[model samples]
Target: MPSSAAWLMALLLNLMLAISTVFIGSCLSESPSKVRLVGGAHRCEGRVEVERNGQWGTVCDDGWDLNDVAVVCRELSCGAAIKARSGSSYKPPAPQEQKVLIRDFNCRGMEDTLSQCEQDGHVYNCPHTKDAGAQCEKSPSKVQLVGGAHRCEGRVEVERNGQWGTVCDDGWDLNDVAVVCRELSCGAAIKARSGTSYKPPAPEEQKVLIRDFNCKGMEDTLSQCEQDGHVYNCQHTEDAGAQCENPDIDSPFIPENVRLVDGPGRCQGRVEVLHQLEWSSVCKAGWNLQASKVACRQLGCGRALLTHACCNKTTQGKGPIWASQMSCAGQEANLRDCPFRSLEKNCTHDEDAWVECEDPFELKLVGGDNPCSGRLEVLHQGTWGSVCDDGWGEKEDQVVCKQLGCGKPLVPSSKARKSYGPGAGRVWLDDVVCSGEEQSLESCRHRFWGYHDCTHKEDVAVICSESIPRL
Candidate 1:
């Protein structure tokens, strides 16, 4: 028989061998097979899955945020993360040994790989139905799609600081409207509505976001378009909204067309409707701000700048008198979408209706003790709101100074430390991309006129030379 001491030594050797085998197995399993995006429309987006034990599985959406999504995007070199999707919208691989390999992820949005993220190993509370999804993009968008009747038509809203807010309709136009439609893979914008009218109650915390969006009509998302960058200059009434027409649906509703003609800008012109293949003028009988708003937004001109009582101006081109009056809730995308009298009532050339949408963005300064320095604000019709400090620098500041006749700027600051304080109203404009060669600040490239992601605390302030009085 073996000695007791020999038996103890033999037991220790077997234990050591067992530990070594397990460690080596773990090491082998960790590498080669990696995290990947699956079940998405594109390779860069889809349900998040990890391979383990030769089986692919999903991750729980619990505590899943942009950080976790970012790590996966970086690992695959698929650009930046556009969204962190929730629910099992993307179906996972079936009947796997492990349906929930990665229980949960706690990444800091800086991890190089998904394995580096903290996970809730041996998850018992999570289920496969809670699987998470992600969308990585070559050009990530700050915009999101939510609460639409179908996923394409709904009140226009934006995300800021992790909170969702409605967009102001002050300067929303066709190009701006089109971007939101295309972002959701929807058809062109058939209607641009205002958040203030016939709309559901927004979250108490819901802010009135981006107002004036200037897209070339081809920008991928609203964030890619030019904006004003301040919130204090707009209201919920100006909250931008849109309803997209699904391209997949053939023969969409094409309403009678109305065009603004003979005005200085695209926004300001006499109203004309298409009838019998020949455009005719709309009568000014019942023309109101509500009706004019629809025309301005539908025409891609923005909100109604001014409704000319030009019942006296003659039509410029070859359009005859058409409708008597048009009634709109100020939310319709098309003027013809509204209730109108198509009966060709008594309307002469002198009774032509004209509407001028906002043009040459109106800007101002507020919250400053002196006119030279303070919070920035812009005028979109009646409401007055402030501008954001994003992308605000020397070049843009110089233009503001020149516009206000403040002379040279002493210190152009993104934060309004020296100013009175944050102003009241919606924060508009963000990521203003200025070329530095533009004469005016408004002329400098910017995001939608009223869209912003910052608070009034981040309002821009400029200290001018005070414009010394020369005797």
Candidate 2:
């Protein structure tokens, strides 16, 4: 009804409005939201944080479960969700600084993004300590034991970023080995071996992923164990290995070829090896404390206490002395793992290698005129501390004297106090009640370690006879 120019203008205005509406709709579909894992051991693990309106915030753990984490893992391109951790276990680092954006995500696990899930975005007072977290099976974190006679025994290796590497043997012990065995479904670890003892060492090009591990021996996997992933200072030869119980075999593997002889006990004696059905003594050439440590560990004894000095006092073996020189770094799990070289034929049985592995009793006489008499102290958790004398008597004195290789008690505990002064640090044991027949002080009844009613002034003292034998 209007003029042609007016009609054209009206049509153009309508077209412009429609185009603007479409453009706005497309922009809304392509959101700029982002999600990430924060403060994890690796990129694929940690507290879940989301970005909204250019502000980063954490997701609340309310109703968080594996289903919610699976959606998150897939959205982040992580493989699969292995764990849905909440509370303090996966608490965000500096959580107070981050806002709580998302709450109660009801993820059906089919949603491509967390934003698509049914979530309560309106948060009230969700605690940051209740932040949601996820551990994903990110395809790169894996572990394996290799190069053993079977699947259970071998060198330890871990995978990271799509490459396999070894673990260093520094401080590698039974606890760490037990974790590996449990992870691989191998039974309890028989020994935590080092060097190329089980098989040839890893290739020189293989990097060491774990420098050191401190597992409490109860972790489901190696990732749960505490480890130093950075700063590797080990060679291929120092690769850690393990010997675990193989169910396929009739019996568990143990170091049976080696034994101790002609000494007070199985743990302390002359080092002998059974070869070709004949037992022979190890020669003194190149014998040292380091080699003795491996021998003691192999025999299921504790650490080596006295090696060279013990040989002179122990009875001599009456057999051929092996013409081999022991060169051990003191970290090998088995004595046979140490390097050996041919020695001269001049060595005799009297000069055989003798070792005394530390017994259960780590008692020592301190501030005394002689090794057999002084204020009594015991080693507990690597700290030397005094023992309370609430129930100290002659029976307690006799046990301490015999345990120390001191023939007998010389003076009564009551009369013995004046000569020795009070001890200094923690009162380790109290209400002592030894039965004289017990071999060591620890074998006797006492209060729980570090539980006592007496002070250091009540520290017990002992005086044994001067006929102290080698301990």
Candidate 3:
């Protein structure tokens, strides 16, 4: 019904709209390349990694001066450059992709980006040992750890401009604690200590730095997390504090330990062990029921399940297999006790063996063979876990003794906390407060099941009047 000229004009307008829409869409979808510090304990310290072309590769630290590092720190939203380090502080991975992405980045401590700074080239001829490392500090704001048993765990403190202040626990949780841990290069946020539960507070100038911190838990540093960053109505007593857990070792995988992981239930999953100071999977080659039997006993499980629905070959982990060519006669008390050969070649993590065993001790003692004379372990929700000594008392020990039918408790001993070995699997319970009148150990005030504020070293132990044999 319209004229040709009118229709022509309408079509041109529609074409223009489509073109503009596409231009805006492309702009919105474009993701800027990012740089992150990796392999260090904190977000502000580590080997430099740039995310470009959808792959993360390392940068050569050969010409890594503090001036260049300042640009990187400021670009990543961390505050100031502290030190530009060379040489890997950690052991290099046995197998690495080792892509050299950036090199010879020269900055004058004022540039906004490495790309903006002068560089010799995008790709450099350098060894991985020359990989750049850096440590950044948030200027005007600083974080420190104190009052903990170790350097890693502690009451968190911060400094702003020239005045020092404490953070409040208004919206504190593990996620917020995680940001602090990452900021400090501590392992992970174990627990948020509240109400002065750790120890007497240190005497200092009373000032609150930041409050109402809202962290998504994935932030690299606390500076990147959302917070009041300004005002609050909290007293110094209500000031927040954090306890972080450092990794047992400075590696991606834990070594010197053998444990089950990623299973739906306990004592089942991919079999992994530490060999040559690196944790790796056990190859399925030469694996059999006899081999599985040794694994079950080594982990304190009763027997191996043969059903595919419950047990099957497991090949889930990253990296190559560690051990192979196993031959077990089914009577071995420990997997390490069984005959096995180490293999460096011809094995992959996908070929790792898997097994599930019958449930272990519903309730038992560990770190000693005696029935009533070791660390307390409870079987709950298909896993064996340990309790903490935070608020443990004689009343709580009495219930444990009564539940085990191990006779009346005699002088609930804290010494056993050291005499008995630390637990291996998980620190499962904490802040247990029991009344002597309770019928069982479960009837006590404590953190939620699987919620704890301790490491294995702080596991609680008990000693009863006499040892009781299992029924």
Candidate 4:
């Protein structure tokens, strides 16, 4: 008979064998079995195909459904399965392409990959025309305002799987409205209404596809909001609706379609403008600091520090040159409002315009005896520059003092210049005006940045009543 130690050794060996079996089985299950979606609008939604024996072939739709598709969507890391389509819904496979090589998927809908699902057999039971297709929520969806007085007001309908459907108003509110307004380039959300408040064009016909949307009012699209996927409990009568104020022609909100791409950050990049749903570059001809200023302000950036011409750098762009011969006087509210010539084919992308804007303005008191008293220097375009005293007064001084948390302005109008002395560098402002109630110096009316006519002798300075921490 074997000793007790030998019995224990056998038990340990069995335990080691069990763990090794599981590790090997898991690794084998995850081995490469390539699957792809083909012949659809985008990568995420298409006819299903799988690779077998070094050849690619379609999947038979004999038993395809949302449950089977859920495995495929999970394998691709797509959010969730929106729909499972077969036959005529997707494009037919080419004549010379391989026939269906996979069929009869019995997925529990939580498998890591389609290959892990139980299949009837490795056999072809259908023709290429009967291939399966899937649409996932990860695909880009389009949103539009319908049945309203104008483009910016009405019933909110979203497009998914190439079909238009209404959103359920179960939890819709101003937060959702804000996202819709920003997406449509409308200024801001005026009101959020329900289907009961604003009757859509046709109620019973529209399908309710989305429900319980949770939005933070910052997303660029409605589909980005967290929501239940394809809720069937909602009726068109419960559709979401909104009223948005159209941005004024000169408002920066109207030109929110402009963006900076392929740069270090949002404020510096090759400039692009959305025209007819396509992004096009602006030609460098006649592009200058004035045009750059409007682009910067419209993008919620600070003053323009350098244009492509000013920096002598080039970033070639693709597609159409939308505008040329820009002639801005540096005060236009939006880039579109500036006078510019139409497209010129002769211009190439190498002449595409770019801009480096000053980061959001940073204020500091320099050359003073203490933290709260000094020449008023502003950090712009990566440099500390002086503000002009051409229109300096207690009103302007009060704003500067409050912004720095320096208690209050100490210099009375009678003794405005207490000899903090003039500052050197670019004169960033001139002819300033303030109403004493503004929060910051930038909010006050002033000449365009870097357009001052005064010299350093007129540089502005101030003395505050309290000393604050150093910046």
Candidate 5:
């Protein structure tokens, strides 16, 4: 054995060597490390690992927080903090040798990298080796509708987070469809459809994934839906859509006793029968003698009349009354009997000049089988709709009698019971109080007109005679 002093010195040396080794190992294991960002826009991710004795080692992410995410964002030059998660992809076999826990980190919320974040220590109790990962992304501020026809049969696209995407038609109901119609201001929702009617064929990538869609009944835009948590399986054919209709209007009746005038030259005049309103032009189309004769007779003019080709001057070279040519068979009754074009033209010399007619004596309808033969037929609505005889009581008939300058009501049938045909769509006339002050039949109050379910035979008719004389 060596002397006590020498033995003591040797022991001390060994002890110092062991301590130095530990210090070196610790320094080697806890050096600064680098991490790389992965993933892409709106969602970002990254991993970090330290170099120990030329070997890469990962730190546990237990200590990662908003501050650390901020540092990562600053380092990467990403705008701001979004989110962070902790867990391990790798775990050590030895319990004590597990990755160090990232207990605490402090950073300015706007920082870009973990390296810039202030940390409590290198050693951590992070549960797994792959625990430190994060995601940072930009957010969208606005949403809007993009393309397609906004009418009844069109597709609607949306823009969000700086990108455009189609809306999934899944779970689309009336409430949702209603909103879309309202947005376009296209009346009400007539139909709601799924399984795309207007999608592009063969798309390279998927378009949209709508999870939950809640729409207010009147919203016209699909983006107005409040989406829930569901991955929308919007395939090309699964895009949603809708259809709409136009609303009904109040005044849609035509006038009576309208006639066309065959002027002195080819540029003759034509007129339309509107409500006691006034006479307007039929404009001009292909004008032939037969059609002119029909128009003249319909206006109570006796026979075939002359024909005129009204030119640019009459149409003023504008509007729907552009150029027109008409053809008619004498058998037809009205000016509309002719088929014509809707453009304007210059009068040609070959075309006959104006047409004239001999007015027929006013003939009233009698209670016999030929009731409608000599009486005028008035049109209501777009079609030849009807009016009810609701107000045709004695007082009403008395007024009609005086207006026609004839006798009293020989027979007043309220429901068209005596004759035959479909009843009017709906009886619009009720309690019609006609006074002798009114001039024409149209000047009566209860003459409201609308769609009627009447056939030709049931049309309202009147009969008048000079006196109780002959029959």
Candidate 6:
């Protein structure tokens, strides 16, 4: 019923539509067969299969989003997401097989591969499939720290595909050695020689898989860079390895610098000299108050105003060096603190030591008749000094008593009248100042001196308020 011209035009339009549909279908069918993942799992950038007709093809990653890349990076452990590109680095997989066409791709630049991205399908017009081709890129091997024969040096072993291995020493260089050093935080690399200095490799272990590793000498780990084929012929004796050294330890204080003086216990205010990189006992000579005060000041104990000299017989036994008797002016805190007019002579090893202290509070005695009553004194220079009973108040007494934690202070004295047994070495009381508010005797002073006041008869002693408690 239509005119001839109208009929002809309709036929042409139908033909054109058919041709267009065919062309579109052909374009859609050109997906890739094989695809490549680049930038590791952190930054996936590549194309995926969309169609396959024997020859593989790729699709554009137009639909990829950040969430998709996040999933990919998380699975790879390559780091955070960076960037995701929809392009082909290698031939895409066959379309007939299950394919990833970039359904949902989200990258934060941390992913190592595109597969890590959360993608769904391929984007048409993708040009990546044309670049389909893959090469076996070498990965770095893991190195661990271990204890070696001398100090803390040890050998390194490589791991791959869950299998442990070693590297042949064929072309070991400073660059390679540097990687090992940086990885272990050890010192600089000393050498990179071939030849076995280490024990033989264990049996059943795979040979080192890397032969030619081109390092820049600054990489922290060998695994961070790329390498060549697996290396063999590197036995325990010929394989590459490294060694490292330990750091130095510090020690500034010792015993040779001390000298004992007169106090209470076998160990009391003592004067020791820090000399020859060691502490040595001094002979008691011109030990006096002045000298004692000087010594106390040197020891940062305020001032040395007291002096005590008891023949070595008083102390338990003469230490390293011994001298009998000590004389000093009240001007110095320790014998060492005094300027000697002439070294004392006729002094026996027993009387060699003396003590000096600035304030008598540096020393204290614990345990005795009363809680506040005990034998204790500090050494200034080489002279021994006693604490004043001033304010021999309960508060002060509490400190002494509680320090010994024996009994309460029944009597407090200002002068050295207790006439306890002969004392021992010099004692050093860091800092002692009783505000009377201290809860316990010990709490009043920083720490007690080495010596105390106690005669052979009473022998200053303490009785705990309670019986010995379990630890």
Q: Pick the candidate with the highest lDDT.
A: 2
**Distance from true location, Cα of 443 in model 1, Å:** 8.3
- Least lDDT summed over 10 consecutive residues: which range in candidate 5? 246-255
TM-score of 5: 0.24
Tell me the tens digit of each residue's lDDT in model 1 across 146-263.
4344445667777565445677676677778788876665666877776554335353335666656778887666777888657776655566667777432222122345677787
Scored by lDDT, model 5 comes in at 0.45
Candidate 2 CA-lDDT value: 0.73
- By lDDT, the better pick of 4 and 6 is 4
Q: RMSD, model 6, all Cα superposed? A: 30.7
How does model 3 score by TM-score?
A: 0.37
Question: Candidate order by lDDT, highest to lowest?
Answer: 2, 4, 3, 1, 5, 6
User: Which residue runs of candidate 1 sit more than 4 Å off their true CA positions?
Assistant: 1-183, 188-269, 272-290, 296-337, 340-349, 356-363, 367-369, 378-385, 394-428, 432-451, 455-457, 463-471
The residue-by-residue lDDT of candidate 5 on 267-339, one tens digit each, is 2344333323344344334545665566665554555544444444553222222234444555543443234
The model with the greater TM-score, 2 or 5, is: 2
lDDT of 3: 0.67
The local lDDT score (0 to 100) that residue 256 gets in candidate 4 is: 27
Displacement of residue 422 (Cα, Å) in model 3 is 14
Ranking by TM-score: 3, 1, 4, 2, 6, 5
How much lDDT does candidate 4 score?
0.71
Model 6: what TM-score?
0.24
Q: lDDT by residue for model 2 over 6-56, one digit each (tens)? A: 999999999999999987875575232667676565546778877676566
Clashes of each: 41, 0, 3, 0, 46, 148
Model 4 has a clash total of 0
Tens-digit lDDT string for candidate 3 (1-471): 999999999999999999999878755552325666765555567777664555556777767899988988877667778889863663231014447677777788897666666655456457777788888874445576655554456666665653445788888888988887776656668888773554446333346778778999988767677879665666767767787775333333223345566686557777777654456766666467877776776665778884121223343777656655656677644454344554445765556677778765466667655688789888766788888787677877888878777876665657778788688887667766565666566555455467665788878888888876644
**All predictions: root-mean-square deviation over Cα?**
19.8, 21.8, 16.1, 25.7, 32.1, 30.7
Model 6 Cα displacement at 364 (Å)? 61
Overall lDDT per candidate, in order of appearance: 0.65, 0.73, 0.67, 0.71, 0.45, 0.44
